[model samples]
Target: MKRHITGLFVLSALLTIMACKKSVEVLTPSGSDETYKVPQGNNDYDNTIVDYYNKYGTYMLYKFTEKDVYWTPTGWKKPTLPNGTWTTGAEVEASDSAYINAQLNLIKNKWFGFYTDKFLKKFLPAKIMLCKKVDSVFTNYVFTPTFTAVKGTKKVAAFYNYDNIQVNYGDATVNSMTAAEQRLFIYKVNLIFMQSIYARGLNAPTAEFANSADYNTAMTTYAQAYGKGIIIGYSNITAQSDWNAFITAMVTYSAPQLNASVAITDQTAAGILNTTKDPSGQIKRRYNMVRNYFINEYGVDLQLVGNATRGL
Candidate 1:
């Protein structure tokens, strides 16, 4: 997917996928006089994943959607400042927790199916609480105040503030989801995990491009074939765009699976893109950066991830 196919697919799926993602049962906030609703069943997941989560992190249930995290003893402890006010950065929810557990289970299962490496398995964030909302105050913080920046940042025997990958369960929930729903959910999780955190590390691993001439030439060739609009800001933000190109390519296995989002006017250039043709090998150069980063950094064969992700 040296092209923008995954980006396009992800964008396309967002507005519609949430509509079908199921609904959540809101619980009464703590201290409310109203009778408390019964908490949902915790989705039992893979034992290895459950053990990793229980031993390393806490699953929290909050009071509302998009509210500040106020954790209870059953969950992780909510961080308190000197003033006794809670840390204000995290978007969260509960049945939501069950749904989240299911989502995490899906991801865990996919990881086992695809990746032998434990990098993501060991570090993936599990929502510590299941609640209605989390206050949004930590926009300025490096992490959203869900978990620590790294797994061991707060490293006390299972008592550190680990970072969280916020899964806002306000709009929908997944419990015993259908195969299709699970497939789509896993796809989105993989995409977000890849773009937001996973790929960011790969951004600066290699040196910046040696020269802009080769880049410019490639852009010109690309513009001529795909139209100037496609590469309009190509030169202005090559690195960021390069990462996107890498993600797209790394996610999709081939042109056949890329759907029709990619509009290639020049059939020859399209062939070159698919590696059926390459006048100077310029098109593949950008893609190689992403592929090489994975191989060199984690010693991972990214093709395995692509194959597994694509299988879903």
Candidate 2:
């Protein structure tokens, strides 16, 4: 009896060891063999929100790349490169080739005038227009309306279908030539364009547009600085009825979902920033909420804004 009892104890110990080994292996990443662990500690999301909105407002630009695409709609097969291929210089130029023609058509159609089209007529200094071929299998790209840059009687320097892009109007104080101004404009334009396209082309067009309120909030906040048109970005929300609904739910109709760890480039969140007052006096800033979530969840580093020439 004593021998048998001792044997049982030995077997149990071996089993426990095996189980622990398996657990350890499960926790290890296959490629790097690194232990995967989520970040701990609560982040000050509310503070981030107040600070972000107080400065950038809701109308800032956002860029959506392959990294931004996630949780696709039902029955919608996402692309391997959901963000689409990056356009080459040659391709970027080809896309711009038609800018002059498009502008002329818009002018002829009376779509633009001194008061009505004043926003579109601004000569974008050093503009980069990205476009995709028509009817291309570029669904994942944040595809939006074509953004073309045109000069008076000059051939369009750039025209291309982008997955998404945006254009914003600012007060004369926000000059396009300033680096900060340029960065802010480009980022906001890209984000706004993305949202717009998503609403129009996704599965549920109307719903997507309505649901993208948070996104719009960000744009609106950004727009306050410029004193003119709001943020405009591209979107592919209306590719299908279901997709539109999904995106809308994700944006306007949903609660603030937070991402802990988001990638932040050095350019955006570096150094002392010139936080602009929320000119509109609206406290809510969509971009701030989004950024807060990203930073809290992912520890994304945010930089401060300062002088434009200071190579932030």
Candidate 3:
């Protein structure tokens, strides 16, 4: 997927932009603290984001103008400072509202609705920018897909670029992506959330599935069947990579998909990779660990969520 594990150095500065190099009160596009009603619509992305703002308030990053903004899920378009150096918004046009809302609704249902509903936590990013175009920010949009506020005690921000990916349908979202695109998108999202501060509470299993003999066998079978790309790949060496790998397992790969992906050379290999045949008695140890974490910590069942998301 042309991906890497650590994105901290790349996107953390995004939060700085959200803070405007200093903390500012939650200012609406009008740059006023007065009550700005969240725009109402059937769009899940807009509604969920508005709901977030209603409860917690949104910090206006930039009063952007020029480029088409992706609404609230990405970043500021062309932010200017207060001293006439620049200003925040370009002024919202009533005519474009319908089209913008349509695109945003597609994005929300495709990928973000999952987070709004499944990411049950209080430590959400204070600022969210759904950029109108990829180049609206200081850096190139390709390298910055989803930036989240996750570093230090400072404020947090999450951004999405609308032009980052291509689509055939007039309506596009996570569901509209190709099989491979969907997988990569899900993987990236998992990594983004997994590396965030909210995911810091996740503790890798030490005993439940860590018996030396059993782990050794699992690793051996995994490597032998999958040829080392599945478990211990390039993006899985970081401190949180293990958890990332686990999330990838739970969300991206189902039990049957995993078992079938294995190259069955022998009964032992087959047994180790197969949940029905595993002698360790845990068909999907990695998946089980992650599933338990969500259920135990967030009261959300990963199996149901995964199945629904993956169309399992």
**CA lDDT of each candidate?**
0.42, 0.29, 0.40
Model 2 stretches with alpha carbons more than 4 Å out: 2-28, 32-312
Q: Which one wins by lDDT: 2 or 3?
A: 3
- lDDT against true structure, model 1: 0.42
Clash number for each model: 32, 65, 16
> Where is the poorest 10-residue window by lDDT in model 1?
151-160
Best by TM-score: 1
**lDDT, candidate 1, 219-295, per-residue tens:** 53454423322221335544455455455545534344432234344432223344323334454564465566666
Q: Lowest lDDT 10-mer window, candidate 3?
A: 150-159
What is the Å distance of residue 26 in model 2 from its true position? 9.6
Best by lDDT: 1
TM-score of 3: 0.44
Q: Ranking by lDDT, best first?
A: 1, 3, 2
Give me the runs in candidate 1 sitting further than 4 Å from their true place.
Answer: 1-50, 53-92, 96-101, 111-118, 121-163, 168-176, 198-202, 208-213, 216-221, 224-235, 252-272, 275-279, 304-312
- RMSD after CA superposition, every candidate: 22.9, 20.2, 17.8
What is the per-residue lDDT of model 3 for residues 158-202, given as tens digits with 9 covering 90 to 100? 223332121111222323556655444444444344444324453
